[model samples]
Target: MAFLPTSYEEMKQAGLDSVDFVYICGDAYVDHPSFGCAIITRTLEAFGYTCAILAQPDWNKDEEFLQFGEPRLGFLISAGNIDSMVNHYSVNRRRRDKDNYSDQGIMGKRPDRATIVYSQVVRRLFPHANILIGGIEASLRRLAHYDYWDDAVRRSILIDSQADLLMFGMGENTIIEVADALNSGMKIQDLVYIRGTAWKTKSLDSIFDDYIVLPSYEEVKTDKYAYAKSFMIQHENQDAIQSKMLIEPYDGWYVVVNQPPLPLSQEEMDFTYSLPYERTFHPKYTYIPAIEEVQFSITSNRGCFGNCAFCAITSHQGRIISTRSVESVVEEAKTITKMKNFKGYIHDIGGPSANFSRPACDKQREYGACAKRECLWPRKCPNMKVDHSHYVEMLDAVRELPGIKKVFIRSGIRYDYLMYDQDDTMFDRLVQYHVSGQLKVAPEHVSAEVLDKMGKPRKELYFKFVDKFYQKNKQFNKNQFLVPYLMSSHPGSTLKDAIELACYLKKIHHTPKQVQDFYPTPGTLATCMYYTEMDPRTKKPVYVAKTYHEKLEQRVLMQYSYPKNYALVKKALIKAGREDLIGNGPKCLIKTYPPRMVSKKKSSKKHIDK
Candidate 1:
């Protein structure tokens, strides 16, 4: 009764045999070219290996795995982009805090659901095929990580999921190397020397002083009760540069090669640009829950130059932007109209910071604007550039495509770059053809200091753009809205800053209910700041908001619509000496006094409450 197929017979009927490798899992929405599946597929094809993607495959139904044809399944690569916790929880399990709750408060612990289901199906269908497991879930859980959110140590994913191997980090280079080694007749045991890969080996007790050493799976799995002791040892010695110990039951040690970032050559860049993409909506699979259905999605560019603290795009794709030609983009649009389910509308055309069509500063210039860091808190590099002309041309070409009724800019346009336009032609085109019932923009934070910390534009610029957008919309009699995506409780935000931001939101009448809390994803500059409070290189303490209450207050102020936030907001405002925003004040958004009533009730029932 599951939503997708699960058996190998069903996979065979679906024409999966034509592929040399079958990527049977992951939940990264199956689009967005830089995702793990796309990267692995492209890499394998580059090395003469045929690949097919089965994104978010339904493991419950046995028929799903059967659809991919004969078991020519040379390898089974699992990026495991979907978090096991998210899949099992109705609420956000990642939001739980240990200080405020017990271990029982942890709601989702079914980490083996997807892996178990996929493993069973794969074994039934292709018993001899190799299966791999990886992603954020596998990486952090590779060793028994202290899950602060769960308040307990969990076993490594290798023991729980029984995957043949677990690949981690930006997996493109690792996956390609793995596939090439296996295809070249290299045994799994022979790959211990490759960096960034983990496998089992023999001899757990002997240790040296060079690599990250982990307890053998046999020792940890000997008794579930002994897990806590082993976890404590690992945690206490996490920073120790111990010599690598060989994993028991095998001849060699499990190795993780910390691979250096690979620079993309011009030829590889050109080849990626030439890959065939329909870029059109197929009615059968155009069911995206986040956005409404439409035809055409042009990839104007790839990669991002801005290395924001909270983003992983730069690490995954690198800071250099790889753009497709304007002509090629238009041709892709033309092909969309030929599809039987074509809707005659281009839904989105962009990549990371879509407006950055060309480099912000010239790449060839030694002393150009691109050589200077724009913001330091989140840490912007000196080489990032912003060019808008290529984007403008891309929009123009798509607009001129045959049978295209309307073109929308659903992908985010970096406001900082867009604000640099000396001419209004880009804005003019946006008004003319871009679908505009609502336009999404990420201002992230409104505090000047927070903005600097996040490597974002000034709050003043966002307001200016908001005013211009409204003015232009009114002139054209269009009822479009600029939906801003804001973040709360980043490294530098304080309660005072949050209250100020709340007052600003009220002043502008910007009541965006949807906001995101900082998640501290790995490899982000912001995360580094949050953890160490020091610049990575300088090793000096920096200003950061570390208290939980301060973070909570800031989050509440970001969404002042909540009833309980009234007292906290009042306290924050008073503490900041901004009594001007009390009740029904000029810049106050909250209208109710329910929190005051609750405070009075608590005072009156103090004797009875105990």
Candidate 2:
């Protein structure tokens, strides 16, 4: 049933004639054609070795491995689209029989099911291959990690995954150097000298000396509940220092951290946009029935300017938006139309902060000048600039392309930046050409303190933009709706904040059913704050959301439209001192919450008395 050559022997006979020096196999989501994979594979291509991307392959099945016959199998490279280290830790922690493992203040929680399954498969299929694992997940867990979910300290994923080397950070430069060395007949052991990778060394006889020493499973396994609490208190600043402790050796397997964030140059951006992207969905995989079926993707830019405390983009791509040219983007659009399966609409064309076409500050010369901890809050950056001409042109070209009916801006666009448009022309253009009934924007949180902590715009700005957006829609007779993305239980959020946000939503009469809970990801500032009460590097006391009730309230307030949620919303409002909004108020939930609550409270009292 697998789409592979008949057998391993058959694959062997097919030979290395068509083989490339390296074969990359891993999660396709991270090795996205526009982002991670494009950068890595192109970089390897630059070094004169043919590198084939076996993206999201079923490494667990022997048949999947046979599709690409052995090409000397230089090194197995994996980094993008895998589970976050925190997610992995959470899985391990949850498996433990302990109540001490809590969600804490993490955001973007996803299961590590793929990585665990894939790693096992790769270990079995490619026993002789030099397996190198890196990416956000592997990098963050390169050293001994105290998994809050697992409630115990765990060893590095590299050792457990059976990878030969582990490269960390943005792997473009490091992966290139690695491929070049291997092509030159250098041994895998020789790759330890690289600055941005983690690998085992022959000299590492006893234990990894560079990483922070954590309690072994044996020491903490029996009393893990107590051990987790102690570990949380002791390593409160673990997130910030976690990356710093990974050391680089002069010669052997070492961990690389603190490498200056790599901003894709204009040329690199052009190359990415130049790739032959068949914007049409692959029909064979279309039966899976997901958004990818109706939607197509194109990257207008790479990286983001908003370095929110909870985000890994700043750490990974740095706070710079490298954009592609209008011509190149149009060319890709044209190619999409030529495809037989083309549905005539390109769903999304943007990347980390789509509105950030060109960064306000020149990072190369003015790196330290833009070192402010937050960008979206306070709006103090005089350097903040907007270039909508390219976007305008790109949208125009996309519309003009044959068979393409609509081009949706599916990715998150910075509302604050978009608001800065001198005129409503961009919004007008978006309404006229881009939107498909709904436009998505992430307001994150409405509470000022919470927004500040999350490095997002003030609540007022979100409302202001919503008003303006709707005003434009009404003026243009457009039926498009605005969908705001909200994050709950961030580091500084509380029940009061959640209640205030809920009240605001009620005031606007806006109800969004899809809201995400904050899942702390690795290498993010927010995660560090969650893990340790202090800034991992600064060791300064910071506000953190630790209670479950507050988290629940935050979630309930975000979607208080349903009758079932009215009591919860009213309770949250009352708890937050916003009882005035409870009944017959502009945002009153009396119609939904009042009747149910009175009867429920009486029933509860009756039960208590009995």
Best by the TM-score measure:
2
Residues 364-407 of candidate 1: C-alpha lDDT, one tens digit per residue: 22222222243222433344443466778878888877788888
Clash totals for all candidate models:
35, 14
lDDT of candidate 2 over 1-610, digit per residue (tens): 1122223343355453444543443333222354455456555655555555554454445676555655553545453444434333432133322111112222222224334445556667666766666656676665544455553455556666767777765666677777777767887866656656666544455443455433443443344343343233323322222222333232234333333335556776677556443332222332212224223667777667676777766555555567888887887777667767667778788887766777665542244324323445568466555567778878888788778888888777788888877766677888777877778788887788788667787877777888888788778888777777778788777777777777667666666656677776545657656656555434556666656666667787787765667778777777777767666555564453444333343321110000
Cα TM-score per model: 0.68, 0.75
Candidate 2 weakest ten by summed lDDT = 601-610
* Candidate 2, residue 56: how far the Cα is off, in Å: 6.5
Error of 2 at 59 (Å): 7.5
lDDT scores in order: 0.55, 0.58
Candidate 1 residues lying further than 4 Å off, grouped into runs, are 1-6, 11-20, 28-74, 79-178, 188-255, 258-295, 359-385, 421-428, 467-480, 531-552, 561-568, 571-578, 589-610
